[model samples]
Target: MLLPIFHFSAAAIDAYVFWYDQNYVDLPFKNPMVKELPLKSRCMFLTIWCLILQIAYHTVAFLNDVFGTNAASPKKKPTIRLIKDVLFSVAFPIAMYVSGAFWGIYAVDKDLIFPEHIAKLYPVWVNHVLHTTVAIFMFIELLTTNRNYPSRKVGLSVMSVFIGAYISWYLTVYFKTGTWAYPLFDELNWPLRIMFLLFSYLLVIAIYIFAEKLNYVTGSSKVEKNLSGKHKKR
Candidate 1:
């Protein structure tokens, strides 16, 4: 299970690197290690990030259950409390789906829009299905947990960070190699590219907000928060 997952993730990382090298307009870092690491180790790194998030989520919840206090409270177990602090106070918003959806859409469209040269190695439907499935699960979990709540500020901040990082990284590539990712963005006139970026960001934000609202209406908010506390703490 781990090996196949690792392989798939490695393939995904390779695809991203290929796209970045080909389409990135600016190259940020000249360090060979930085360029090579993502190509060779991004899969393992991302997988580790995911596993850490999962573990932290479960650990915090467990601690909360045992202590009968919110992890946010300073009086709780310091280690568990710190993890909860980071998970809820930092990573949650960052990991939220609002901005991620834009990349998800782009990943799908890159294949369809430029079928002639791109060869569409990965199936678009698979990307959509997998993303949607994981998103739904995350939503369900959030809704079921009592502490979960939608914050526009948090969502917006996350979106901003994602876009800023993506642009900055690509800009570095562009400067170094004069390339951009996803030719659709480069092929478009500047005006169209800007419009697309804005539209995708707005659409993703709206979708995420709507999902949060749905969770609220369905009374998943409390459940999700509670579960988060229970499952996320160690």
Candidate 2:
């Protein structure tokens, strides 16, 4: 259903993105602030990683829905469920953060995140696909499915590691390329940089907490509690 469609669309659009990277010519926009925010090391961008996870999560979900069907066709196989939950934990928060942060900065000053010239030079669809659609599908999936969210401690720990890894990655990218992945980082001084990084970590942590609480409010916690009670009785 929605799972298969998400999988196919993400995959197809991603392929086009790569092709666009190669086949398309350079953009007209020119600015030190914009630098190459360029297509190279596109994988180094969280947006790309989120899209990859989108493809991965939906592929797994689709297979679990299709091939895993039986008497409990509706109930996911234990292994598939575990993998899907892990991807869900990793994918959803990061996707939301990318969209929220990107658009917020874009709204404030397109120069800090996405330069206005790029939007004018290239198709607007590319920007929305990378920044908007990823989160939209995540929201749709959140409403459409019931997931066994991990415990708060486990979920937050993994998010910490994931964010830490990305921080390390972009630092490495900056050192190697002499350019920050996003212009927002380039615009900040040392004290402001530290404050901004700290703020970002706190913001993402808040987002993760909100999403976990949301899953609980949406009824996943009830099912989890029932399972816990059943296990305790046994």
Candidate 3:
């Protein structure tokens, strides 16, 4: 319960900061991306929402354990566990990896990735707080807490939907505004854009496989149990 509250607060704070800091321009009504920045700008917001969902289920399960009540249903536990795994293993990694790449590019040549004006709004620490700290915090959680991952098929399917949906959303934003949401999309030609998207998805899939191996090698099998009614807490 307490941990969930902390995650919720942190995510909410980041959202607030982005909006408040980017308030210089009065966005046009036509561009939905500018109007709904948090929803369309980055996949980080989506991952944070996933984290909130994961924590909500975890809170319920924890309460049930403490109260000795079967409040957290068996069916719901599996679904939530699967979502948690997909978001942490797939979504979080994608956001971290993509952000790191662009942040590096921006460091080399700021104009190539982030425009001078936009770059000024986000200080170095702010960038780290938004992009870097999220993965670090979740990774620490994964290492300390027991987590049961869904099967590879389910994990891949879920992550596919997530990445596909974001692509569609960006396409919609482009159609509406006649511009791309992120600078990287603007910088790349159509062929390069398609290749980048494909590469990103493939990278996420590879990371998913790596996470499975890491979980096994770290003996999470002994610490975390599947949601099929066999769960142990250390």
Tell me, by lDDT, which candidate is best. 2
TM-score of each: 0.49, 0.77, 0.66
Evaluate model 2: give its lDDT: 0.68
Model 1, 1-234: lDDT tens digits are 222232244335434533443353223434554455344322212222333343355445455445534422234345544444334433333334422643555567845233434334334543332233334434444544334432668656754665565556654655555544445556677788678767755654565566556645776434534444443332
Q: For each predicted model, how many residue pairs clash, with residues at least 3 apart or on different chains? A: 46, 0, 0
Candidate 2 colliding pairs? none
lDDT of 1: 0.44
Tens digits of per-residue lDDT for model 3, 1-234? 433454455556555545554564333335554566553344333333444334443444343334432222243454445445445555445555555656676678777665767566666765565556655655544543345566778877877887787678767767765766566677789999999878877877777777667765675433333322354332
Q: What TM-score, to 2 decimals, does candidate 1 have? A: 0.49
TM accuracy, model 2: 0.77
lDDT of 2 by residue, 1-234 (tens): 544565567657755764675467354433443345545446557776776677677677666556542111234356776677767887888888889988998889989887766566457777777788888877766655567667778888888898898788777767766767677888788799778877888988888777767865775434434433431111
Q: Distance (Å) between predicted and true CA of 79, model 3?
A: 6.7
Rank ordering of all candidates by lDDT, starting from the highest: 2, 3, 1
Ranked by TM-score, the better of candidates 1 and 2 is: 2
Candidate 3 segments whose C-alpha is farther than 4 A from its true place: 1-83, 220-234
Q: lDDT (0-100) at residue 41 of candidate 3? A: 44
